[model samples]
Target: MSAITLYTGAMLQGAVITLELTAGATVVSLIAGAAGAVGRLYGPRTLKAFIFGYVETIRGLPAILQLFILYFGLTQFGIDVPAYWAAFIWLCLYGTGYAIEIFRAGLQGIPEGQHEATAALGLTRFEAMRRVIIPQAWVAMLPALTNFVVLELKNTTLVYFIGVQDIMFHARLGVSNSGQPLAIYGIAALIYIVLNGTISRVGGILEKRAAIAS
Candidate 1:
């Protein structure tokens, strides 16, 4: 079989794995990010401090180190984690840190009077955030969140380091089988480009809709 054909056929499973990891990470990041932002913005002083430290610490580390800690380093200490779950958790945690910052910036961008206005209307803090603040913040953060989603998708390739059967891992397999590293790697790169481009287009559409809505 031609190298391209071989690589394409073998990559199906890897592609599915990539999608699954990306979807899981995206969901985790959104939920965790929103919570983190809310805590940092309005929670008690101690909670805000804790959240800040957490975000800063995670953001400071390279994601690959985080993956290595979960997959390899932890095992040495007798805390064995499965490779797939390790990747999932690491990406979610890594993405959550950035997501929190994105969301926090969105929240901070809103005028303070809006919060006061919600209070003036006798809305509780929770209700005010839900009804007034979060919607607008979401609109502001959508582009950044979309970028993170794409980055998380691309970062799934890093799972290959821990032996997760992702696209890059399969590409390596194709290279081994076909002895055509350049062609196989080219196909892998194209696959990544296509995936990221699709996400960028979707994000553009969403940004326009948000602009019109706002």
Candidate 2:
């Protein structure tokens, strides 16, 4: 079989693994992000300080460093883990920090008067946030959050560093098998563009909806 054929088949498995990592990481980021944002906004000063420190620390580190720290560094503790889990945990944590910032901006974007009005009308703080504040924050944050998720889709390739056999790895495998580096890597790059482009289009639609809501 030709190198292209061999790599093309490998690319299929790589795509599958890539999608799994993206989906898993996105879910984790969103859930953790929203919760963390709420805590940063409504939690006590100590909690806000803690969240701020965590966000700044992760945002400052290169993702490759984070992956290495999680995969090799953590494994030294005798905690059995696989490349898939390592990539999943690191990406989700990476995305979580950014998502927290996005969510914080969304929460702050809501008018202070809106909060006052909700409370003046007999709503408790929790009810005000739940019924009025969060809905609006979601609208404001949807665009940024969508963009973050699409980025997550691309970031799944980081799994290659930990040997997850992601699409990039498959491209390498195919090149090895067929000795056609040019065509194999070229095709792999095209697939990434296709995936991220679709996400960009979706983000535009969501942005429009958010604007309309506001």
Candidate 3:
């Protein structure tokens, strides 16, 4: 096989792993972020403090360091975290910090008068949030959230550090076997470019639809 053909086949397999990891992390982060935003905004004092600290700590720390702690550091205590789960949890928590802030800003952008209006209609807090707040916040939040999603997609490359067989990992393997660092690494970079480009395009489409609806 030609060099290009061989590289393409291996990179495609790596691409699948990359996509699966990104999808899983995105889903977990979104759910966690929504709950975190809600709790930080309206929960009791202790709950707010805990959520606040979690978000801040995650945001402040380097994600690679967090992954190292989870993957290597924990082994000292006999806590064995598989490479996949370690990467998964790290990305989820890391992405969730930004997700919480995105959602919190979105929620805060809603006017207090909206809540007052909902109350005037005799709606409960849950009803007000469901019927009035969250919908608007979702639209307002999409652009930032989309940006974060793209970042998370790029961040999946970091899994290579932990020995996950992601695109970057495969590229490194190809470099070792084929002795062509530029060619292998270039292919990996191109794959990332394509994936991130597609994400940007989809995000734009969603934003347009959201704009039309609002």
- CA lDDT, every prediction? 0.89, 0.86, 0.89
User: Candidate 3 — which pairs collide?
Assistant: none
Model 3: CA > 4 A from native: none
Overall local distance difference test of candidate 1: 0.89
Residue range 1-214, candidate 3, lDDT tens digits = 3765687688889899999989999999999999999899989999999999999998888878888998999999999999999999889989888888988999999999999999999999999999899888889888898898899989988999889988988888878878888877888888988999999999999989988987
The positional error of residue 90 in candidate 1, measured at the CA in angstroms, is 0.6
lDDT digits (tens) for residues 1-214 of candidate 2:
4668767778978999998889888989988999899889889999999999989988999888988998899778987678888899998999999999999999999989998899789999889989999888888777787789788887887778678989998987778877888898889988888888887888888878777877
lDDT of 1 by residue, 1-214 (tens): 4767978877767988998999999899989988999899889999999999999989898888889988899888899999999999999998888889999999999899999999999999889988999789879888898899998998899999889999999999889888988888888888888888998899999989988987
Question: RMSD per prediction, one decimal?
Answer: 1.4, 1.8, 1.3
Candidate 2: lDDT of 128?
90
Q: Arrange candidates by TM-score, highest first: which order?
A: 3, 1, 2
> For candidate 1, what is the TM-score?
0.94
* lDDT of the structure predicted as candidate 2: 0.86
Model number with the top TM-score: 3
> Which structure is stronger by TM-score: 1 or 2?
1
Question: By summed lDDT, which 10 consecutive residues of candidate 3 come out lowest?
Answer: 1-10
